[model samples]
Structures are given as structure tokens and as C-alpha cells.
Target: MEEMLTEAACRLGVRGAQVAVLVGGELREAATGIANAELGTPMDARTLMQIGSTTKLHTAVLVMSLVDEGLLDLDEPVVRHLPELRLSDQAATASVTARHLLSMTSGIDNGFYDDPADYLATLSRMEMLFAPGDGYSYSNASTVVSGALVARLTGLSWDEALRRRVFEPLGLRDCTTLWDELPYHRVAVGHAPDGSVVRPWTFSRASGPAGSTLCSTAGDLARFGELFVRGGAGVLSAEACAAMHVPQVSLPTRRFAREWCLGPYRRDFGGTAVFGHSGTNYGGSSTLLWAPSTGVVVGVVCNTPHAGYPLAAEVAAEVLGAAPYDVEPVTRLTADAEPYVGRYAACDLRYEVSAVDGVLTVTLEEVASGRVSPPVALLPLERDRFLPERDLSGGRGWDLAFVVRQGRAVRLVSGGFAARRMA
Candidate 1:
């Protein structure tokens, strides 16, 4: 395991990595490389690394606990708990429910706000990408709202609720929603692609519920994963636990993921059903995968962005005796893509489509950063449906589907978000 970890870290040019694998009711851990590249600190089992969006799982469990206690309803409109909830779309603001937030189908525009209050305030000024629960769009604001709901219903802060409800019950002593809350010495420093250190180790507190902040050791995360395998042993009812694993929305274009459940992303690994979550912050990446049939849970953390996926994949293959199933190949069709060539905008994201030498290509731009990603060639899968040659960031499947109206592309849908064509 250590050899595999070392190889993966080296291959990805990561400074360090830590992994925990649970099998046959026994937990095994391995660590390799430096926790702090400058200080030459070694990463170990106790090293705390940011788990990123994986924190969503913890938040989901907290909500489930409330549901178990009859304090919350999954289908209740969020405004019922926080009547002040306001959005640019008043109807969506009133109609959005807890179930939509948990399932990432709220259709609220995604943004990173400094605090939960700020998120809600900004949401109130933004229009919905789609009607509430009309489509799947991963929104950090939605999770922040969910966390706020938890706070309101439990009479506790999101952090406090997590501590009292999740960390304490699951015995995750080394986990925390805030970076500063962790002991400085035990925390693993994050590093950029160039190996430079990243400051402000955590995202803003407002993003905590949506997976912006949460630092924990691999071992601590494995213990949390065990809860799912054990069917909610102490914290959640079996029914609630089952609900967390059940598929809530289909995500066909996502690489390995088949659906988004209450919290975790669901996928199939070598014919065995596996559910888990992956998280990435500025300079670090982490993943937690568990298969109930085999009782195997794998948790991996790396101090470099995008390094955890390959490492976690290797670990999963070793434990499951087979790799993740291959993504279905997109069948290219013979169709003219000229009508689809145009610029599309949605919230902070922009899409530029063009055709050159009879080949169609698409590039996504971040409006705020003015950063345009490299153009990816799009192959026609149907008249208006296409698939990117490669996967987009955020595990969004390579599939790109267009909504055409009056012989012009109206919207480009991919990565669970829709970008309307700019006139």
C-alpha cells in the first residue's frame, strides 16, 4: 500500500499523501512523502488534511439525524424553517425544499460567498438557472442554505451541530469543519501545482455545509465511512442511512458517477455498488469511497490539487480486485454543428463554441477570473447532443447536450448546469 501511495504521489507530482483502507472489519493506513515540502515534515496517519466537499456527507448525516429525531422533513420547503430565505426568483425561493438542496437539484446559481448570510443575500439577487428541482446544478449556496437550516432547526451553529451530532457520535476526534480549529502541528499544508504553499488553508465558513471547509485525517474519515457500511450504526436510522445511498438524480454525463444521492455520489465499481464523495480545495484533494458488499472503505488525501483521484482509483482497484467500469463511448454522428457555434453565458460561467476545419470545439471561461480553459473538441452524438473528448473539472461527464430552438442552439447543458446562448 505504501509503495502504491508513493508511486501515485510521485506520478502526480504531489508532495505527500495519506490513505486508509477498511477491509474485513480491519482498517489499514499508509502515508508517504512530505506533509510540508519546505519543512520536510512527514505525513502520517494523524496528519489532518482538508477533505473539501466530502464535508457534504457529514452535513447530510447531520440533517438525517434531525430527520430521525422528527425535527426536520426532507420535503419541507426551506423557507418554512427560515422564512427570510429570499432569492431573485421569488417562486423558486418559495418552492425550493430541503430535498432539492440535499440532492443538488436546487438549480441555484453556484458561487462562493464569504459567509452563509452573504450567500443567501447574493442568492436573493441572482436568478435561477432552472426552476427549483427542475434540473441538477451543484450549488455551494444550496448547501450553505441547508446548513443554515440545520442551525435554525437545531438552535446551533453548523459547526456546533456537526460536532455534537456527527463527529462526536462517529468518534471522529481528528475531524473539524474549520481549519484553524485543528492543531497547527497536525495539519497538513496544501501545495499548488508548482509545489508552492497555499495560504488560508480553508475556504470561507459560509461554504462549510457545501464542502468548502473540513479538515480531517484519513483514519478519522474511514471511521465516518464505516457508518455507511454498518448501516448507520449509532448516528442514523437504517432507513435514513438507506436514503443517503439511494440515487436521487441521474447524472449520466458524469465520468464514473451514476447519480447524486442525499450526500455522496453513487457509482458502480466492478459490478459492486459503491457510494462516496470527493473534494478538492485550492491546493489539496481528498476522496472517500466505500462498498457495502465488500465492506471496504477507502479514504485518501493529498496535498496537491487533482492528485487524489488517481491515487484513490489505484487504491480502489487494489481493494476491489478490479478497476472502475469504463465510461460508455460516445457514438459520433454525421451532423453539421455550425448552428451550435456561439457564445453562451450563465451566472459566472461562459461558454464559447466554434467550428474550425469542419470540427467543433468548445471552451469554458470563468467570467470573474477571465481565465479560458483549453478548447475541447466536441463529437456529435446526435443532432444536437455531443460529448467532449475529455472530462471537465468537477467530475462532470464528457457528455454535452444542447437544447435547440428555431434552428439555433438555445442552451448548452453539461456538468449539470445550463448556459443559455447569448444573443
Candidate 2:
């Protein structure tokens, strides 16, 4: 397993990685390379890897605990608990429920904000992608709002509530939401695609509940996954946990998961529905996948930003004999990629898609900083969905689906967010 970890991470250009596999009540652990390539710190069990938005699972579980206590209701409008809350859409402001937020069905776009005040203040003027529960779009803003809801109802900060509810209940020792606690622990800093360290290491704190501050060791993360595998393990009722794995909304592509659950991702493993989640920050990523049918859970931590997909995926593949990213080979291009050639906007990033030599190419431009990413080829995997051929970053594949309106394409949907055509 150690050899496999070293070989795969090295092959993928990753500097450091740690993995934990839980199968049939036995847990296996392995680590490879350097945790901080810059400092030459070796990866170990103590090295805490930022799980990014995979922290959403923790928040979701925390919120579900609130539901179990009769402190919150998933179907209730969010404004009922926090009357001051308001969205850019008037109808949505009164109607958007907690279910929409956790399920990633909220229309709120991912925006940078300072705190809850700035988040709500900015969202009040911003337009959403669609009506609440009408479409699926990953929203850090929505999760932040739900985090605020957690704070409001619990009379405690989001950090305090999560620790008391989810973290402590599962007996997870090497996990935390506090940034100051990082200095005392073995931590893995992020490295950019150029192999440079990710400075600042953190993004918007307002989105912390959406996974900005969450960090954990691979074994500890696997233990958290085990809680769900145990059917909530007394912290959450089996029924409540079951609800979280229930499909709230379907995705545009099945290359990953066919649908989005209340908090975790819902996918099929050997015909049995399984739940898991993945998260990526600027230069680091992690994944916690649970295959309940097989009584297996895979937790992987990596210091490379794009490592979330294939790193966790590769480890899981080694354990389970196959992973989700191993797609059926697209031997020949059958779909027309020309109609999708246009500019599309997704939150802070804008994409410029053009056909070079009649092949679809995507160039990413950051709206806030005006940074442009190198153009990459998008190969057709299915009808309107295409897979990104890995570039220098070693980032793995994600399905990019074009949404057509009228007779032309109007949006490029990838991951969970839709990049609306801006050209």
C-alpha cells in the first residue's frame, strides 16, 4: 500500500499524500513523500490535510443533529429562523429552505466575502442562478448561510457547535475548525500547479462552514466516515443519517455522482448506492468516500489542489479494485463541440471556450483578479459532457456539460456549478 501511494502520487506529480482505507472492520494507513515539499517535512499520520468543502459533510451532520433535537426543520424556510436574512431574489428570500442549501440546490453563486454580515449584505443584491430547489449549483454562499443558521439556533459559534456535535461525538482527535490550532499540529500546506506553495493557505472565512477551515488526518477522517457507516453511531439517529444520503437533486453528469444528497455525494458502487464527498482548496485537496454496501470507507489527503479527485480515487481503486474516475474509454469523438464555443461565467471565474482545429478548448479567467489559466482541451465523453484532459497541474478529470438553449449552447456546467455563457 505504501509503494502504491508513493508510486501514484509521484506519477501524478504530487509532493505528498496520506491515505486510510476501512474495509470489513479493518483499517489500513499509508503515507508517502513530503508533507511540505518546501521544508522537506515527511508526510505522517499526524499531518493534517485540509479537506476543503468536504467539511460540508460535518456541517450537514451538525445541521441534521439540530433537526433531530427539534431545533431546526429542513423543510422550514430559512428566514423563519433568521428573520433578517434576505436573498437577492424576493420570492426566494421568503421560500428558500434549509434542504435547498445543504443539497447544493440553492441558486446562490460562490462569491468572496469577509464575514456573515458581508456575505448577507452582498447576497441581498446579487441574483441567483435559479429559483430555490429548481436547479443544482454548488453554493459556498448557501452553506455559509446554513452555517450562520447553525450559529443562530445553537447560540454558539459555528466552530463551537461543530466541535461539540460532530467532531467530539465521533471521537475524532486530529480534526479542527480553528486556524490557530494548526501551528501546533503536523499540517500539510498547499502547493500550486507550478509546485509553489499556496500562500495565505486560506480563502474566505465566511465560507468556513462550507469547508474553509476544516482540517483532519486521514485516519481521523476515515473514523468520521465510519460514523455514517455505523448508521450514525448514536450521535445521529439512523433515520436522520439515512435522510442525508437521500437524493435531493440530480447532477448534470453521472461521471461522479448521479445525484447530490443532503450533504454527501450519492453514487453507485456495484449497483449499491453509496455516499461520500470531496473538497479542493487553492493548492490542496482531500476526499472521504463511503461504500456502505461493502462496509468500506476511503479517506485520502493530499497537498496538491487537484489531488482530491484522483488521489482519493486511486487509493479507493487500489482498495476496492476500481474507482469512479476510470470511465469507459471514449474511442471516437461523436458529439459536435463547435456549438459550445463561447464565453461562460461561473461565479468569480469566466471561461473562454473556442474551437482550435475544430477541437473544443477552454481557457479560464478569474473575474476578481483577472488571472487567466492556460487553455486545455475538452474531449467528448457523452452527449454534451466532455472530460478535461489533464494539463501541467496534474488535475484529474471532471465532466463538463454544455447546456443548450434555443439552438446554441448557453452554459458550461462542471463539478456542481454552471458557467453561464457570457459571450
Candidate 3:
């Protein structure tokens, strides 16, 4: 299995990758690639990596724990608990409940620029993109507001609430919310694909609730996955764990990935439903997944900012497919060649999907934002499967791809973008 993973990493040109398989509480660590591409630090079990939006799972766990204690209600308006929050849409603001935020159906647009000055104000300024519960749009503003709600209800900072309810009890010594908030030595420095170290600037702190501060080692993350696979014994109740698996929204179609639960993006890998979330920051990426029925969990931590799914998927497939556990990869079929071909843009986000000379090409609207490059070009890798050019971000050369289901692109598999188009 180690050799297989090493070969995959070499093929993908992953600079630093760590894979940990947790079976029935036992763990196996397989690592290849350099943790520090410059000084030649090999990734191992103890090395910490940023687990971006996967941090939302932990936040969701904390919210569920509060619900379990009768201190919070999922159906109640979040504003009822935290009266200070005022959305620009008065009606949605009054009606939006905690559940709406968690499910990413808050009708809010994603407008989080990497500007600290606009962070707090942006949440209240963006108009409700749709009515609450109308559709699912992955909104950073939605989650950050959730963090604020938790803080308001508990009368504690989100970090303190997380510590009291999660980290300490789970014995996750290395896990933390804000990496910079922690002592400098313990946090892993994020890196570009070329091995140049990159630290989060002022803009990073603004992305708090959605994909903010989470730092952990593969060992610690495996332990986290184990708790979920084992029915959330020490952390949350079985009922709470069950709620986490309920499907709240149908994701865009993708061939390589599975569907999504309320919060976690899931896939049927090796005959078991692998429940987990993939995360990406500017220069780091991580994933934590587990199969409860099989008692198999997998954790992959990487330093180069955007290499989560491939590492996690490869590890889970190898360890979970040991024996007796067998499942077929669902072959995705697509036929709609019209609805998918269009130029779509909302606010600062832009992309165009069109059939050019019998081939479908999706181009990013580069002239608009003018970041590192334009929207990524995705070339078909298989039937309904496509792989993006690595180093597309100039330095973060993660060769990720996507699957088109029906006419919508599902999970952003390669880039770790957690967006699904609305119907």
C-alpha cells in the first residue's frame, strides 16, 4: 500500500503527502513526497497540515453537541439566539435558522475578498442571493455567521467554545482553530507548489467560520475520524452522528466523487459510504474521511496547500478494500450538451462552459478578477471526468479535476472548491 501511494504521489508530482488509514481504531501511516520541498522534510505521522473547510465538521459537531444539551435548536432562527446579526434581507434574516446556515442554503452570495477591512462588513452587506432555503450556495458568510451565533449563545469566543467542547475532550493536542493564534512553532507553515513558504496574510483571518483556522497532524485527524466511525462516543451522541450523515443537498455531478451529506462530501469507495470533507487554503489542503459501517477511517495531510482528495481517496481505497469489502465505482453518464454550455457569472465569480468543435471546454473569466490566472481549464480525463493543469495557481500545482452530472459540475474535485450549482 505504501508503495502504491508513493507511486501515485510521484505520478501526481505531490511535493509532500501523508496518508493514514484507520481500521477499527488501528492506524497505518504511509508517507511519500517531501514535507518541506526546500529543506527536504519528509512528511510523517506527526507533521501538521491545514485542514481547511473540514474544520466545518468540527464546528458542526460543536453545534450538535449544544443541541444535544438542549442549549440550541437547529430549527430556531439563528438571530433568535444571536440577536445582533442583521442580514441585509430583513425577511431572510428573520427567518434564517441555524439549520439553514449549516446546510449552506442561506441564500447569501459568496463575497469574501481577501481584504480584512471588508470581512466583517461584507457579511451584512451582500444581498440574499436567494431566499433562505431556496437553494444551496456554499457561502463563507453563512458559516462565519454561524460561528458568531455559537459565540453569542455560549457567551464565549468560538475558539474557547471549541476548546471546552471538542479539542480537550477528544485529546487532540495538536488541533487548533486559528493557526497564527497558536504559538508559532506548533503551526505548519503553508507552502506554494515550488516549496516557497507562504503564510496567511490579513485576509486569512476573515475566512473564519467557513474554512478558517484548523491545524492537525495525520495521527490526530485519524483519531478524529475514529471517533465518528465509532459512533461519536466520547465527542457526540449517536443521534448527532446520524444527523451529520443526512443528505441536505444534492451536489453537482462529478464522475470521480460521490454525493454529499449535510456537511461532508461522500462517495461510495470500496462498497462503503466514505463520509468526510475536503479542505483547501491558499497553500495547504487536507481531508478526513471514514466508513462507519466498515470501521475504516482515512486521513491525508499535505503541506503544499491544495492536495487533499487524491491523497485521501488513494489511502481509503487501499485500506478499506482489504478483503470481503468490495464495491464497484459508479459509472457516471452525461448526455445534456446544451444547458451546460453557457457563460455564467455572479458578482466576482465568472466561468464559461461551451462546446467547441465537438469538445466541451470550460474557461475561467480571467479578464475580470485577474488573480494568478483566469478560470482553470479542465480537459477530459475520462468519460465525464476532467483534470486541470497543475501549477495553474502559478505555484500550487495540484492536478485536480471535476465530474459533470446531468448538466451541472459537481464537487470541484481537483481544486478542492466546495461549490455546487443551484437548480
Candidate 4:
């Protein structure tokens, strides 16, 4: 495992990494490379790493908690909770729901590029590409709205709500929403790939719901995963936990590394469906995935900005596979996977595929030169498989699959991979 972490970091060009794997309620910790690669500080268990979008799982739990309390409805409109969110277009404002925001179909583009101040208003001003709940485009603005809704429902700050409802009950003392307020004596400063200490940006407290105000060690996160594995640890009821894992929408990469149930958890790992969240913040990456079937929870945190959340996924994939359980491979055919074999025009490349050895191997051709080169081969595994060819050193794979529609494969999913099987 130590060698695996070192190799992963080196492949990602990351200077340092820390990974924690939970198996059957026991955790195994490993650190490789350096935390401050130039300063000679080694990555360790206590290193304070960021868990970016993984925060969504936390917020989702909070949302479900509110549902358990009858304070919010998963199907309710956002305007019912946050009337202040007036979009530039009134029609969109009228139709968008809390579900729209939670599921990332709010029609707002990723808003991180805009100044934090303008985030909400800018999102409001943007025209809806499709009606709410009609399609999916991941937007931080949606999660931010979720944070705001939680605050409004509880009449407390997001940080306070999370602490009183989650951290305190879970005994996650190391976790806090206020990263800027963290005591510098114990916290490790974040670094870029080149080893320069990154200037900490003030995460928009208003937008923090989407990606802000959370910090903790792998140990603390493991405990949080345990709570969910234990059906919300009396914080929420068993029924509610089950509801959280219910499929709220059909997503492309819905099941990667694990299945995308309602909340951030995957269903049926080694036959156990664990419920938990995965997060990545600027300059940090994290993953807290567990398998209830085996009672194992893995929580990983890495401090390097570019270490990326995919590292957590790499860890999860490895951990789950290593568990001592039998996963009966479901035999599904790839015969319908032929149509996806044509050219996909992206910004700069043409994606093409050809059948190889009864499987699909993808090739990204540089369009200008028409030079074809091999990419990681994506094989069919009961209708889906991981990107067998990504530069796994940084740890991100789409785990793509061929979506069969109308008795034929029609689309290739992102995060979850799919390609047309061409002759």
C-alpha cells in the first residue's frame, strides 16, 4: 500500500499524499512521498487535507436530516425555501426546485470561474439550457443553494448547523467549516504542485454549501462513514438512511467506484451498499466511501491541490476489490455496444473506437494530423467497466459504461465510461 501511494502521487505529479482505507470497520493508513516536498515534511495521518465536492455527501446528509425532521422536502421548490434567489429570467426562477439543485440539473454552468460575489446573481442571470430536472450539468451553484436552504431551514449558520447536527454527534472534533479560522499551529498549509504554499482564498460562506467550510482527518471522516453505515447513528433513522440511497435521478456516471444512489454512497459493494459522500475542495481532495455489506469504511484525505479527488477513487476501487468477499460477476452482453464506435467531436480531439479481442479499445485521434494512437482500453464488464487506460497515477477513471436504449446502445456515459463497439 505504501508503494502504491508513492506510485500514485508520482504519476499524478503530486508532491505528497495520505490515504486511509477502512475494511470491515478497521482502518489501514498509508503515507507516501512528501507533504511539503521541498520542506521535507512527510505526509502523515494528522495532515489537514481538503475534501472538495465530497462535501456534497455531507450536505446531502444534512438535507436528508432536514427531511427526517420535516423541515425540508426533497421534492420542494427552492423558492419555497430561498425566495431571495431571483433569477434574471423569471420563468426559470418559477420552475427550479430543490431537487434541481441537488441533482445538478439547474442549467447553470460551473460557476467557479466567476468572482464569488457574483456567483449567485450570475447563476440567476444565466438562461436555462433545459428545464429543471430535464438534463444534467453539474453546477456548484446548486450545492451552494442547498447550503443556503439548510441555513434558512435551521435558522443557524451552515457551520453551526453542521457542527450541532453532524460533527458534534459524530465526535468529529477535528472537523470544522471555518478553514481560515483553523489554528495554524496544527494545520498544514496547502501547496501547489511546485511546492509553493498556496494563498488561502476566503471561501464564500454563502457559497460554502457547494464546496466550503469542512475540514477533518481521515480518522474523523472514517467515523462519519461509520455513522452512515450504522444508519445515521441515531442522528437519523434507519428508514431515512435507506431513503437517502434511493435513486433520485438517472445519472451517467451514477455508479462509479461505486453506485450513485440518492446520497453520495454507492449501492452493493461486494454485495454491501454503503452510503457516504466524496469531496474535493480547491487545493485538496478527499473520499469517504464504505461498504455496509462488509462493515468497512475507507476515508482518505490528501493535501496537495492537484492530488485531486480521483485519488480517493483509486483508493476506494483498490480497497473494495481487496475486501474478503465474493462479488458474483453478472454476465451482460456488449453486443449492442457497437453504435458508440463512431467519432465524437470534442474541443480538440476526435474520439474513435474499434473492437479488439472481443472488447472495445478507445483511441483519441489528433484531428489535425489524423494520427491515431491508443488510449486505455475500456472493456465490457456486465455492461460497464472502469477506464482501464487513464493515467491512474493521479487516480481518476470514468468507470464508463455503454447505455443500452431501445434494445441498442445509444450513449456513452461520463465518469462511467461507454464506447461504441465498431468493427
Which lDDT tens digits does candidate 3 get at residues 275-346?
A: 787677755678787877878777877766644555555665667773122122232222443445555444
TM-score of candidate 4 relative to the true fold: 0.72
In candidate 1, stretches whose alpha carbon ends up further than 4 angstroms from where it belongs are: 113-117, 327-340, 380-423
- lDDT by residue (264-371, candidate 4, tens digit) is 645454555655666555557777777666777888777776665656656766777742222332332345446556554322234665565445666666545788
Give me the runs in candidate 4 sitting further than 4 Å from their true place.
1-13, 22-28, 88-91, 105-107, 193-206, 253-259, 265-276, 322-395, 399-423
- Candidate order by decreasing TM-score: 1, 2, 3, 4
Best by TM-score: 1
Q: Which segments of candidate 2 are over 4 A away from where they belong?
A: 113-117, 270-272, 325-343, 352-363, 372-378, 388-394, 405-410, 421-423
Sort every candidate by lDDT, greatest first: 2, 1, 3, 4
As a TM-score, model 1 comes out at 0.91
Q: What overall lDDT, based on C-alpha atoms, would model 2 receive against the true structure?
A: 0.80
Give me the displacement of residue 106 in model 3, in angstroms.
Answer: 2.1
Q: What is the C-alpha RMSD of each candidate to the true structure, in Å?
A: 2.7, 2.8, 5.3, 6.4
* Candidate 1 local lDDT, residue 284: 64
